[model samples]
Structure formats: C-alpha cells, structure tokens
Target: MDEEYDVIVLGTGLKECILSGLLSVDGLKVLHMDRNDYYGGESTSLSLVQLWKRFRSNDKPPELLGSSREYNVDMIPKFMMANGTLVRVLIRTGVTKYLNFKAVDGSFVYNNGKIYKVPATDVEALKSTLMGLFEKRRARKFFIYVQDYEDDDPKSHEGLDLNKVTTRDVISKYGLEDNTVDFIGHALALHRDDSYLDEPAIYTVKRMKLYAESLARFQGGSPYIYPLYGLGELPQGFARLSAVYGGTYMLNKPECKVEFDTDGKAYGVTSEGETAKCKKVVCDPSYLPDKVKKVGRVARAICIMSHPIPNTNDSHSVQIILPQKQLGRRSDMYVFCCSYAHNVAPKGKYIAFVSTEAETDHPETELKPGIDLLGPVDETFFDIYDRYEPANHDEHDNCFISTSYDPTTHFESTVQDVISMYKKITGKELDLSVDLSAASAAGEDA
Candidate 1:
C-alpha cells in the first residue's frame, strides 16, 4: 500500500466517484477508498431490512411491506433532470451504458392549499389553472420569450438583456402576478428561494430553459429521470468508469486517517497501518470534520405508501415543489416519490419523501405540510441531519473536501460542485462534451 498516485479520493459518494473517473480518464493515476464496504457514503440506498435496522431498531420489518430484497430505499433522495448537468456527465463518460433510465411520471407545484402541474410549454401555460385568464396570457407571452431567447441569436433577445436585467424586472414586464411568479421562480427555475429574483435574469432564464428542455426529453410528463433501480447504481457506474482507466479501489477500510507533511499539506492516507501516498486527496465532509462547519439542518420524512400522491394523476414517480411564498417559509420544500415501477420498492408500493431545510426542532411538524399531501402512509420515518460546508480550505494542504449534501431533490448543485472541484484539483475544466468510449467496454447486464 506504499504506492504513490496523482490523486487519492477517500469516499465512494457520487461526487468523489465522478471526479476519480474523470481524472483517471484524463490519464492520471488514481486510487479510490471508502470506509464503508459499499458505494455511496451519505447517499446510499438501503434495503427494507436495512431501513428497519437504522430507524426501527432492527425488529424485523412487517411482512406486509413484502420481502426486504425487493426494496432499494435511498438515504438521500433526489432525481436527475433529464437534460441537466449530471446526465451530461453520465453520457460524456459513457456511464449510461451500464444503466437504464426511466422518465419520471409528473412534476407538480404546491399552490394555495392545492397542487398544480408546472407549465412546461407555451400551450401548457395558456391552459394552466395556476393563473387567471389575463394572467395566463401574460405567462404565455413570458414562456414564449423564454423559449425563444437564444444565447447567440440577437433576434431572440427581443430588446431585453438577460445579463444586465434582474429576474424581478423581467417578470414585472409581463405583468405576472405573485402566484405566477411563484411557480416560475421556485418551480420551473428550481430556485432554492426567492433570492434568485434579485440576481441576474440570465441564471433564472437558463434554468427555466433547462427545465423545459428536460421536460421535452422523454415527453413523459416530467423533466426528471431515474435509474432503473435507484440512485445507488450511479456511483457504481462511475466506479466502473474509473476501473476501466486503471484506477484502484479499496473498501471497508477502517479508520483511514489522512497523513500530513511537516508543512501541513496532505501527503497520504493511513488505513489498517498501511499508508498509500498521493499528491492530492478528495473526500466528503465526514472525513475531515475540523475543516467543515455546520451551516444548517435538513428535516425529512421517508414514507412507504400503497398509493401515489393524492392529486398527482396516479403518477408512479413525481416531484412536488412547495414554493416558499405559498408555504410562508424561507426556502422551498420538496416532496419526491417513486414506486416499484422504478424498481425501488415492492410491487404496488411507493416510497415518498418530504424534505426541507430544518426550520424547527421537530421534523414531524416541520414536514407536515408536505406530508399531508400523502394520503395514507403505510410506514414513516422522520430524520434530521446537519448540513455542512468547508470552513478551512488550505491551498497548501492538498485536501479537497466536499460540502455536505443539501436538501434539494435534484443533482444540479451536486454536479456543479464536482465540476468546480475537478477544475481546482486538476487545473483544467472537466470537458463534459468529451466523449469517452473506454468506459462502455463492460455492459453485459443480466
């Protein structure tokens, strides 16, 4: 284990795995290690029995939930936007060949005590019940403006400059009401809060375009996609990519301590009394606790249900966003659901999660608004975990620690962090446009 490498990644989380694979593909020698035997550190998917063990004290799961092996419950639940950054990375690295994907069934937004489908196209905008007749016309025009606005085409600009204008200014031009603005900003744009309304309109506009484009990917009602089994397959897919590039992996390594040089820069990792040296180290927040600080907390409710969410058209999988304005909160709340159709649960059963930034001490109460939308949950588990970010990044210390996962049920931030960290570590931008066929050499799925 004394061998030296260019980079030694210390976690099997999706971000670390993607980086290791990208670096390996770039012809850098890499070594990946995880304290746990399985992939996905904080973002793992567990079986029904494992879920019982973690939250229910391992008192054998109820038989009514079906066999434990039939379930693949995600610890940190999120969906991949069909045309989003993660999908681009997956395709670029040829990780798609190792996995199959299914389009999500629906995407809804919580309004004034009701739920409404997010308008994806100009036609849907005009037909939406989310706005009044006059407001619908206004929204339809805005949708058209967004759909037609191209980055390189000046004619599409229509006398407006997204780079210099504010999103709030653009919405006001259309005479859009507060409710229309709510779904547009929080739902379609997928903003974490209303703060984006004050930022440059370009960011929000691009997000809206991405959402619309993703919705058009499968035309299956929503803009998101999930793997056939669950997100657990994602890390493994990237791990395979790394392996094909001659990267080595070690799992179930205990008390893997980062060894630093006399000058404070990380030099290697010591595990089981054997030290493997490396020029740089990348890891999740859990490894270097002192370098990260708690920023906030996430409260979530994991539920098992026999039926789809009440008002979602009986969709097998869906994402329902609760805007901060409608919910009177500082941040938008998210409700993510998937069923056996996605191979995440037993037949006829669904896994639904209601998650948001922790505003109160009680998770059961904090997530009540989103939980109420679920008709009757066969089983429910409430949990709250701290969110952290790097507090001390020693440029001299070659440790590139990742921030804790946020409460968002999307991969936008996750993929962005991976890309940014890749640049900082390798001093080169990760070219998502670069196609790598080397990773597709093994796809003999049974």
Candidate 2:
C-alpha cells in the first residue's frame, strides 16, 4: 500500500493556509480544500481594483522587525494614544502596501470642502477630537476592569459578563457624549454585529485599548497603516503563497453535505455529491461542534459598480449612512460606506461593498420590501461621486453583484451587508462575485 499521508487539512482559511503552508514546506504532503470557490476565509480579497485610488495616498508603514522568522512576514509599527494612554501596533500580519490606514490623530474636521488638521499629541488635543464618550466619566471603571480581565486569549472577551451587555446600555449608564458614543458605535458596527444598539461597554473599551496598543507598537506617531495595493491584495498574496506550496485550492464548490463514520467521527465531505475522504480535518470549532449541530446563522451581500457618486469625500475611507430609528428600519440597520484601499478599482473606475445580516430561517422575510439592495446599486455610485473634488477624478462602469448566506455563524454576510449599504449610497458595484458555503466537521482547530 502507498504510504499514508502525513496530514489532511480541511478549509483554506488563512489559518489553514498558514498551517498547511508551514507543514507542506516542512515536507508533509498536505491536501487543502474549502467548500467555497475562493480562499482566505474571513481575510479574503475582491477585484477589479478601482476603489482604493480615491482616498489612499500610497503610504507605507514604518519598518519593524516581526516575531515570525519562519515566514518572511514584513510588518509596520503603529502608535495609538487614547485617553492619555499610549499603545503600539506591532505586527499587522496581512496588510496591503498601497492602501494607507491610520488611527485618527489630533483633530481632523471636514468644513468648507477642506480638511482641517489640528496638531497635538496630548490628551487635550485628543479630547478635542478623539475623545471617549463612556471612558471619560468611567475611566477608572474601564481601566480597573481590563487589568482584571484575561489578556491571553484574543477571544477571551466572550468569557466576561461585559460581553453580554449592549452598546446602548453602556452609553446611557455612563452618560457618554453623543459624538463619542456615535464614533464607537460605528466602529463596533465595523467589527462585530451591529444588530443591537446596546452592547457590552467592556468590549468597547477593550477594543479601543487593543487598537491603541497596536498603534503604540509603531514608530510613526500616527497609529494606522495603509495598504500599498487594495486591501484584497494582502489576503490574495497569502492565498497565492499557499498555492505555491502545493496546497489544493477549490472555489465555488459550495459544500452541501458532510459524512461521518458510524463511530460519530467525521470522515468525509461532499460538494455537489462528489465525495472525498479525509483523515484529519481542521475547521473553526464553533462552526460545527458536533454531528447534530449542522445549522447556523450567517448573512452577506456584494454591490459593485463603475461610477462615482456625489457628496462623497475622497479622503474618507469608511463612510457611515444611517436612517433614523424612526425611519422604521431596525435601529441595528445602518449603512456603512467602506472606501476601497489602493488599487481596489482600475483607472477611472471604483467599486464599493455592502454587508448585512439576514436572520436564518427567514431569508426572504428577513429582507424587507422596496429595498432593492442588489440591482439598483448604481444610484449609490453617483451620490458619493459628486461629493469629492479631485483634479484627476473620473467615473468608471458598473460591474456585478453577489451574495452569500451561511447557516453557520459566518461573518462574511455581515461584511456584505456593509458593502451593500455603501452601494446604496454610492451606486457602485464590485468586480468579482463569490459565495460562502460551509460543512460540518469533527474535532477541529481554529
């Protein structure tokens, strides 16, 4: 008989890519696969690259040594200062080189069609700009809590009671300023789910601290990094690297079923009725805890286009558009207009994304009426295109739209809803289209 392979890897997410790449490079015959057509699980990329050129300045992060020597990982350092505290951003594992992203510093205000920058690094300067709404009054509360909170595991916040709290209650309890509260609320929408107005104050505080900490690690007084190309390039680069290491990559397979042995051990997976054997499988543990746990909640959408919109700022990377709660939509529903990083669009063209969450078991009803989030994507394009004034500004053509609905707590749908919100406001579409499909697997590692 042929020698048994050393390992069989499941999923092509970044962790799988990284692990399989390392193992294969070490001479193990690793077979990597994902139910989806694309790679890079959460950290994936999209194309055609016309989105990032508007706001990005082709800046690079300050050079810094990385902790990972086994892989040639080049990272930049960033510094973050909040509430008079200083923290650094040490290593951004997969950041693009052309797109520049930095923490808001000193004071920046948009007025009279120009950006006004106030130069200061102290608490007073930040108070005038990056002030904390809840922390200012309850600074001691946050600091004391964090010092006592577990700091080892990245997801340890889940263990704390604070995670159960909502963002709204935290703000009301602390009497935080509306401006500060809005800023953080928007940021939370960017990171986690935005379906609830109330959230754990602890998470908000910790996240800010984490961002500040990342920034502090950088040499630049500024606490942000911009990608040289589009943000997708970073993940794409990783995917390319994984392919170079002899790992198998399959996109658009849409895994439909997972098979298990009589002993209750996962043994194989089927995509569109095609079966494949597996000796060892690794997946995000929460995705499938047991043989019986087959379903979950996930939502995603994509909107692409070629035209620029009015009232959009070229310098603003992330844009927020929200209808009042009185507008009848859930308070949780708001539009996020995320700007593309460098090269996200081609010359004279740009693309935007919209992400949202549609409750499982109610996909059709979950999505509302009169809300053509998919087809009328172009209207949003012109709204944002007319807002910015640039010497070389030009409009491009419309592309395509796509969506993904995963029943397994997949976060991509959330990202897609956000991109869709942008399209609603900008009327632009994306260049590529893909969906995420998941399957149950046995004992696995994230």
Candidate 3:
C-alpha cells in the first residue's frame, strides 16, 4: 500500500470507480481502495441471504421465495435512460463490453389517483387518457416544439427563449391542466420535486428530448434499461476498466482514512500500517463524513412479490412515477420493478422498490401510496438514508467527496454529480463524444 499516485480514490461506489477509471484513462496514476470487501459499496446488489443478514440480523430467508442465491436485489435500484448520460459514460469508457441489459417494459405516471402510461412521442401523447380532447392538441404542439427545438436554430424556437423562460411559464402558454403539468414535469422531465418549475425551461426541454430520443433508440416499450443481474455489474464494470487503464485497487482495507497536511490539503490515505501518497483524493461521503452534511433523507421500500405492479400492462420490468401533486406531497414517489426476466429474481418472483425524498420521519407510512400499488408483497424491507453533499472547500483540501445518492430511480442525476466532480478536480469537462452505436448492451425486450 506504500506508493505515490496522482489520485487516491476511496469507496468502490459507482461514482468513485468512474472517477478513478476516467482519470486513469486520462493518464493519471490512480489508486482506488474500499473498506468493504465488495465491488458496489452502497449501490451493490444483495442476494436474498445477504439482504436478510443486513435487514434482519442473520434471519434466513423464507424457502417460498426460491433459492436465496437466485435473487440479486439492488440496494439503490435505478434504471439507465437508453440515451442518458450514464450510458454515454459507459460507452465512452468502453465498459459496455462487461455488461448486458434489458429494456424496461413500461413507463407509467400516477395521475388523478390512477396510473397511466407515459406517452413517449407526440402521437402517443394525443391518445393519452390523462389529457382532455382539446388538451391533447395543445400538448401535441408542446411536444412538437420540444422535438423541434435546437438551441442554435432560432427558427425552431417559435420566438420563445427557453433559457430565459420558466418551465411553469412555458407550460402555461399551452393552457395545460394541472394534472398534465404534473406528469410532464415529474415523469418526462424526471425532476425530484416541483422546484424545477421555477428554474429555466431549457433544462426541462432537454430532458423531454432525451426521453423521446432514448425511447426511439430501440423503439422498445420504454426509454430505460437495467443490467441483467442488477446494478452491481455497473461498479464492477468500471473497476475493470480502471484496472485495464493501469489503476490499482484494494478491497477490505479497514480504516481507509484520508490524511491531510497542515495546510488543510489532502496528501494521502492511511490504511492498516501503510500509507499511499497522492496529490488529490476522491471519495464518497462515507469516506470523509466530516466534510459532508445531510441535505435530505430518502425513504425506500424493497419488496419481493409474486406478480408485477398493477395497471402496468403486466410489465416484467417497469418504472412508475407518483408525481408530488398527485399525492399532495412535496416530492415525487418512484416505483421500480424487475423480475426473473432481468435475472434479478427467481423464475416466479419479482423485485420492486418504492422510494421518495422523505418529507417525514416515518418511512413506512410515507411510502404507503406506492406500496399500495404493488398488489401483495411476499416480503418487504423499509430503509431510510440521509442524502449529503460536500460541505468543505474542495480547493482548500484537494479532497473530492461525492454527494449521497438521491431518491430518483434513474442515473441522470447521479452521472451529473460524477461529471461535475470530475470537472472540479481535473479542471476539464468530461469528453463524451464517443460514438454510441459502436457500443452495444446485449439486451432483450423486458
């Protein structure tokens, strides 16, 4: 462990592994270490036995759920937009070779106390049951405007500047109903809360365009995809990439603490009796807890079920969003479901998750609206984790700490955090111009 490098990365989570890999590819000597004897850290997939051990203190899983090893339930379950930034990162780093995925079967949104499939195109939007006959035409126009929008092409802007316009203002121009705006914002834009409405409209337009383009990629049932086993493959894939690029990795390294100099800048990390020197240190919040602060709490319910979520057209894998307005909550609630079809569960079993930015202390009660849609759960586990962001000055300490994962069931925000941290540490924007078509994820229709 006694060595010098350009960067010493702590935590094997996806964010840390990705930074290590990208930096190594950029010709930086990097050393990555983790305290846990695992690859995925907090984002790792857990087998039924492992899940039982963590949540139930060694209680054995029920025999009715099938072989315990058949399950690979993700601790932080989320999906990848087929054309989103995460997939771009995977392809750019050539990490797609180590993973396979399946297209999610459907994308649905909760509207007026019921679930409806999210229209992925203008044509579908016209036939949606959630909109009125007149409202459909208005929405169609809005979708078409988004589809035709080009930041450089003023002709496509319809004389409206989204950069200066608020999302609420942009939607109000079409006279959309409150329910229509809820789904469009929370489901299509994929915002965690209503806060985006007050921000610039350009961001919302781009998100909707990403959804449309991703859905068009395979013309599949939905725009999202999931790994064959679970998200555990993601961190492991990046780890392999880093190693191939000459990055070193150490696992089961106890007390992997960041060591800073008297000038308040990090210089190395200490573990066991050995220390590896570095000019910069990157780690998750857990590695440098004192440098991060809690911003919010995420409440999630992991469920084992015999069937799919109701009203999803019996999708084997699906992502459903319960927008904030629909439930009179301050934040949206997300439901993610996967089955043996994705190889994450037994042949007759399914794995589902209901998560939200927790607004209250009671997780079980806070997630009931989503859980009620899951039909029946053979087994369920409720968890709450605090979300955090860097509190210390990165420039002062040369220590880059990743923000805790948000409650969204997508990788867009997570990738954004990694890219932002990479820019701050390297003083260069991540280059993602690699051709996506050259990289393929072996997949089937979910």
Candidate 4:
C-alpha cells in the first residue's frame, strides 16, 4: 500500500481502462481500482436478471422472454466504426485478439416519415430513393468528388477549399436538396445535430471519407461492427492488456477516495484504510463529482423483441439515425438493434435501444419517435442519466476525469474523449495509426 505508482485510475469504465492500458504500455506503473466488482462501471452489460433487478425491482421476467443468462444487454450501447480510431486502438494494443466482431447489417436514416438506407458509395447514391433523378446525379457527382479527394491533391479540390468553406456551402455547390443535406450531415457524417453544417467543410469531408472507407472495408450493408457477446468485452480486453503490462487492478474496493495534496493536486487513492500513492490520478466523473459539471441528460429505452426493426431490410443488427429536422427536435435520435445473430440475445430474440439527448422530463414520451419504429417489443425499460464533463484542467491538479457517455450510439465521440484525456495525462497525442486493412481481416477471421 505504501508503493507509489505513476498513475491511479479510479474506474473500470471503457475510457479509464483504455487509458490504463495505454499508460501501462508506455512503461508507467498504474494502479486501477473500481468500487464495483466488475470490469465495466457505468457501461457494464447486464444479464436478464440483473436488468430486471435494476429496473423492475423484485418482479421476475416472464418465461416467454427467454432464459435470463442468454441475454447480455448493454447499459451504454454503442457500435464501433469499422475503420475508426477505436478499432485502430484495439488492433494497435493487440486487444482484438481477445474479442470477436460481427459487421452491423444496416445503416438507415429517417426522413419524411420513412427510413431509408444511407448510401455510402456513388452506385448506391444513384439508386437511392432519398433523392430525385437530377438530385441523384448531383449527389453521385458529389460522392465521386469526395471519394477522389485527397488533402494533398490540388486537382481533387474541385475548385472549392474545404478548409475555408462550411459544410452547407459544399452541399449547396452540388445543388443537393435540404433532405439530402440532412442525411449527409447526420447519418453519413455521424454528426449529432445540424451544428456541423456551420463548421469547416474539411471536418465533414474527412468524416464522409472515413464512412465510405469503412463501408468499403467490409463491403457490408453498414460501416459499423459490434462484438459477439456485447460491448462488455471491450473494457475487460483493455484491462487484460493493462495487466499484461504490469498494471494492477483492484475490484470491489469500498470508498475509493482520491487523496489530494494541500496544493489541490491529486496524489493517490485511499480504500479500505490503505493508501496507494501516485503522481497523478485518472477517473470517471462519478469518482469526483465536484470536479465535473452536468452538461445535459440522455434519455434511453431498452427493448426486447422477437423480430428485427421493421423496414430495415430485415437486418438482425442495424443503426438508424433520425435526423433532428425530421423529428422536429434539437438533437438526433438513434435506434440500435442487435439480435441473436450477434450473440447478445437468445435464438429468436433481439435487443433494441432508442436513445437521444433528453429534451423533456418524460423519457418515454421523448423517445417515442424512435420507439414507435420498433414493430413490437416484449418488454421495455426507460431511463435517463446525466451527462458530465471535467470542469478542472489536468495540468493544474493532476486529476484527469473522463466525461460521461453521450446518447450517440457510435464510438467516434467516445474515442475522441479518450484521446483528449490521453493527451492531457501523458502530454502526448495518442498515435492511432494502424493497418486498418489487416485489422479488418483479423476481425473477419474472428
């Protein structure tokens, strides 16, 4: 207990585990502790019984819903982009070897009271019903331009400077309709709202390119993938990586308190009347609430069903993005569904989630637009959780806290938060460059 470590990570959440792994891989001694006796903190996956216990209290689930052990429902559901930063991190850290991934079956967008697949290629764009005949031609041309665009290739710039223009400007140049712009910005680019339209076009261009590349990687219906068992495998895989590199882990520790120096710098963590010294501390916002501020709240509904989401090409797993404009809301709503094919549920069962940034106090009513899309749910659980971010700088107090998870059912923003915290803690940007092709192959083999 008297030994000092370079860092003490105070939660077993995905972000904390990944940071612990990265720091340990960098030859820093890390002491990872979680008050709960589990690898995942807020992001843990629960069995049917656990889910029932948390949401339904003493009531037991009906037998028609299937066996309790057969269900692995994620508390914070998200899918990985096939070629995104998180996948790169997994491959780079050799954590992919510990997990198996299956490509998601569909990626659809909601517009004009209907859902349609998001076209990732020029061929699909030409066939898409989301646009008119002339609009399809314009969109195809725009898709081709994006596909051929290279940051260093002046000829590929199409006489437009993405860095100097807004996404709205670029979309208008192609004469795309407002509906076309909605899907392009929110679905294909994975933006949560229309705010990105006013941002630099370069960012959206890169996102579109990434989406296209990811779709091309798997040649699947969607650009995302999920683990076979659920997202619960992620934190544990990273924890194993951290352990292999000499990081220590302590689960079920009670009252894991952050000890601070008189100058307000975090120096260690105390638990069970024992103090383990460390030069710095990293943790989720829950571990040190005073250092964080609530930014918003997320409303979510977890549903168990016997069939795939209606009108999603009968996909066993899918991600549907309902743009804010279509829903007449301030933020986008997401529908993520995974079935027995992904090993998250029983043979004939599917787990679907409807989530969004909370705009009203009634989560069930707020998520009605998304929930209504599901054909029929055997059971549903509604919840709302507050979102938070660190209010203090790590440079001042050596206490780096991760922000609460957002409602977006993708890893892009989550990984950005991890990378941001990694830079703050280590004073270096995380090198995420990896052979994505090779990693995709490995995932396929898995």
Best by lDDT: 4
Among all windows of ten consecutive residues in candidate 1, which has the lowest summed lDDT? 437-446
Q: Can you list the residue pairs that collide in candidate 4?
A: none
* lDDT for each candidate structure: 0.89, 0.35, 0.91, 0.93
Candidate 2, superposed: residue stretches over 4 Å from native: 1-7, 10-29, 34-174, 177-182, 188-201, 213-236, 240-259, 268-277, 283-312, 319-341, 359-446
What's the count of clashing pairs in each model shown? 0, 95, 0, 0
lDDT score of residue 343 within candidate 2: 36
RMSD per candidate (Å) reads 2.6, 16.4, 1.2, 0.9
Cα shift from native, residue 218, model 3 (Å): 1.3
lDDT of 1 by residue, 141-214 (tens): 99999999999999998888899999999999999999989999888999999888889899999999999988
Which ten contiguous residues of candidate 2 have the minimum total lDDT?
Answer: 437-446
Clashes of 1: 0
Better TM-score candidate (3, 4): 4
Alpha-carbon TM-score of each model against the true structure: 0.97, 0.46, 0.98, 0.99
What is the lDDT for 361 in model 3? 90
lDDT of 4 by residue, 188-291 (tens): 99999888989999999999999998887887899998999999999999999999999999999999999988999888899999999999999999999999
TM-score order of candidates, top first:
4, 3, 1, 2
Write down the lDDT that model 3 would get. Answer: 0.91
* Candidate structures ordered by lDDT, highest first: 4, 3, 1, 2
